[model samples]
Target: MSADDTDFLAQRFEAHRGHLRAVAHRMLGSAAEAEDAVQEAWFRVSRSDTDRVDNLGGWLTTVVGRVCLDMLRSRKSRAEEPLDSTPHGAPPSPAHAAPADPEQDALLADSVGAALLVVLDTLTPAERLAFVLHDLFAVPYEEVAAVVDRTPAAARQLASRARRRVRGADVPEDDRVRRRRHREIVDAFLAAARNGDFEGLLDVLDPDVVVRSEAGVTTGAAAVARGASAFGSAALTARPTPVSRHALVDGAVGVAVLVDGRVERALRFAFVRDRIAVIDIVTDPERVARLDIAPV
Candidate 1:
């Protein structure tokens, strides 16, 4: 390509940089690695003649997917085990350490939750690529097949396997253990609430924890602690004692309040650094009925 042509290609690549970066980050779970993959894609694309290329965006996405797949495979070969096997609260191994970057942090919080990232890390490179490209980004399985060097039907199966893992089906042993730990924390919180232990509630809650309910929003540990203690007292005095059971509310550790063996209320929790950072109380009968409550 001539200088002018090169410049034009650069501009086009810049136009798709944001989307490409998002794809790579979701695939590799590292901002730095994602940028490297995009750069590699540009190098490969720039050298090739694209005069016949009809869909520039689609072409670019496939090239980036290819680059990310190679990077993920490289990482996998060097690592001893899947990331999900890492014990909770343990420092990440070097192969898995993503630099602390604000942009990557924002990307994680916006695109995929931290928990989902952990699950994704357990997927094989081809599986991750198939799922991230076809399932998440809406790339056709045909394109995904070309990128992963698999038949279209085979590519679909890869994404299907990945989808089940990401959805908490066929989970790894350690991942199940992590979920158990999260349940333990929820159990502690519920126990504290039932006993009217103010300090106990605060122990598991983040200092700036926020609770949202049908009634209203409450912020801060002290405020939520007070509400929890009050709820506990009310539960004790109210007829047909309310029973709190640890259950999976929307695939996360949560508490379901049962009155006379029927779920009447649910508390969905979002954890930050193993502390309860947010609690969504679902009391609306319709909403509560819609929740996918399952035994943990």
Candidate 2:
């Protein structure tokens, strides 16, 4: 291939760079490692003959996935500290080293992703790849099978098994029930916000609900509904990150708002009779600084 051909290929790869990084991030659970995997994928792509490849984006995604799979396997072989060597929501010990990246710390400390990543850490490399690709990325089982060296049917099964694990059946019987309930409320709130379902928001929220943030606190269902609506509007336009993660907020069931791979805010909930009564918004800077590991 000519120099022009290599330059053109590099440009094409750049178009898929963000997505490739996201894939690796979710797979490796470290932004730094994810970027390294993406860089490796670019090198591999540059060397390979893509004359027969139809979808350049899809091809690059598969390459990145394969690269990340290898990294995860290598980490496993090294028996490195589990990503959450600390408890899922535990604060770091002062005697230990602090995180290398504060924003990345927010990803785990303030987002549902922290607990989810802990669960993903338990899966085999092939299972993680199969699930992250097919389930998260919507890659076909046939394509995923190629990455994991399994049949399409087997790859689908791998994802299913991984999915069950991700959902936490192995958790203690008591903990599982509590997490399930938290998941329900958080899911409902997110759905309501995304769909502009005011009634739905009111349904789960107590009539005397209070939403407290650094900005100020809004009390009562009507006031709370209006505040949520404004937030929903901004989310729909500004970032479109209506996704919330179930996390242990200050030791209770809470949800965190994830935007562009960072935790924008976390809400610690106080429930009364199965209805959301108090929502303490764990805003960044303070939340990131403290871990608000403080119990409610």
TM-score, one value per model: 0.51, 0.52
Instruction: Estimate the lDDT of model 1.
Output: 0.76
lDDT of 1 by residue, 1-296 (tens): 68788778777777887778788888988766666677677777777788899999999999999988887887856863232323344322222333445854573554455567788888999998998887556587899999999999999889878776877645567656667777888888878988999999999998989888777889999998998898884632224777777876754568887888889888788676568877888888897896667765
Which candidate number has the best lDDT? 1
Question: Which tens-of-lDDT digit does each residue in 225-266 have in candidate 2?
Answer: 766766774632235644556675534567666678566667
User: What is candidate 2's CA lDDT for residue 119?
Assistant: 83
Error of 1 at 217 (Å): 35
Candidate 2 weakest ten by summed lDDT:
87-96
